[model samples]
Target: MATAYISTPLGSAKLEGDENGLNTVTVLEQDEPESKIIPDVLIDAAYQLNEYFEGKRQNFDLLLNPEGTEFQKKVWSLLSEIPYGKTLSYLELSRRLGDVKAIRAVASANGKNPLWIIIPCHRVIGSDGSLTGYAGGLHRKKWLLNHESPSRQQSLF
Candidate 1:
């Protein structure tokens, strides 16, 4: 698989993929000298991601092959259904999956999502509308939510 470092508003990210499809998009604190070469698949992903960050693209159009178990795949699939500028609680996600008892499992799978914003995992929040666990950090999660919301903006003062 080929890989390359991609810089984003959240931070630097490592994108990996091949002709089969994009495999992973991981956040990195520093650039790794040994990172794989950027392949065409990943290049397209990066361009799409740039458009997403700039609010020009609401939906992605790239091949994705996130690795996970069947149950995790199911959870990720449900997460993708969450519309832009909206949020879902872990309990709600569990219920949607037709297994309320899987709340914890659902949250676990959410944390393990490899696609980040592309998979829309950040749309999941606490039941009381509070921000919750996000692998990329809560601040980034808040930033993402705000970015998707039309009413949010930084104050000049």
Candidate 2:
């Protein structure tokens, strides 16, 4: 597999992938050195993620290969459909998955999402509209959501 480290406003991200597709894109709490030579797939992912953080890109267009159970994969897929700047509650996500009673299970899957920002798992919130669990920590999650908020936060030129 090939890999690359991308710098972002909130933190740096580790992008990993291979010929098959992009695998994981994780935000690192600590610093990591960017690879001098990055794979083509990882290169594209890193570029897209950079654009996303800059508000220059709204959607990702990369082949993804996030490893997970069938249920988790399904949950992650739905997360990808949540439009940019929009948020969904775990209960709502569970309903979309055709099992409202699986709210906790859906949240569990969201917690395990491997693609990070690309999968948009950060958009999922508590049923009460409160920011809840995020593997990347609540601060980063709030920053990302605010960055993507559609209600124009006044452009910086």
Candidate 3:
């Protein structure tokens, strides 16, 4: 397994994976250098992430292999279908997954999403139209949503 650290708006993040795909993306309090040499895959991931943060890219095309339970995988897969600049409620996500009662599970799966912007777990919000739990932090989630929907801003002029 190969691991690398990359900087983001939220903080420094640790990415770990191999040829199988990306396994984990963990947020860290501070930047930490990897003991091993940075692999091409991790380098590519960092570059893509930088582009994403710069608003130059709206979607990610890197290889990913986030580990999770079957249900979580299903939820994450559905999350990827949400278009850029769009948002969905946890209940809506649950409904799309064929069970409105699975809202809790769907939210849990969203929280466990390992690919961040690639998988778009940040798109999920509360049913009442409020920002909800996000592992990356709600402020970052709001920033992501706003970045994607710049047109929604009200002009003072």
Q: Order of all candidates by TM-score, from best down to worst?
A: 2, 1, 3
Candidate number that wins on lDDT, 1 or 2: 2
Task: Estimate every model's Cα lDDT from 0 to 1.
Answer: 0.86, 0.88, 0.84
What tens digits encode model 2's per-residue C-alpha lDDT throughout 1-157? 8878877887778888898899898889997876777777787888888788778999999999989999999999999999998899998999999999999899899999989899999999988889999999999888888888876675211
- In candidate 1, which residue pairs clash? none
Indicate the TM-score of model 1. Answer: 0.91
lDDT per residue for candidate 3 within 1-157, as digits (tens), equals 8888877777778888899888787777676764356687677777787898888988888788999999999999999999988899999999999999999989888998988788899888888888899898878788888888868475211
| Candidate No. with top lDDT | 2
- Work out the TM-score per prediction: 0.91, 0.94, 0.89
TM-score of candidate 2 against the unseen true structure = 0.94
Residue 50, model 1, lDDT: 84
- Give the worst 10-residue stretch by lDDT in candidate 1: 30-39
lDDT of 3 at 126: 88
Q: Is candidate 1 or candidate 3 better by lDDT?
A: 1
lDDT of 3 at 12: 78
Q: Please, what are the lDDT tens digits per residue for candidate 1 over residues 1-157?
A: 8887777888888888888888888877665553345566688888888899888988888888999999999999999999988899999999999999999999999999998788999999999888999999888888899888867676111
For each candidate in turn, give its C-alpha RMSD to the true structure in angstroms.
2.9, 2.8, 2.9
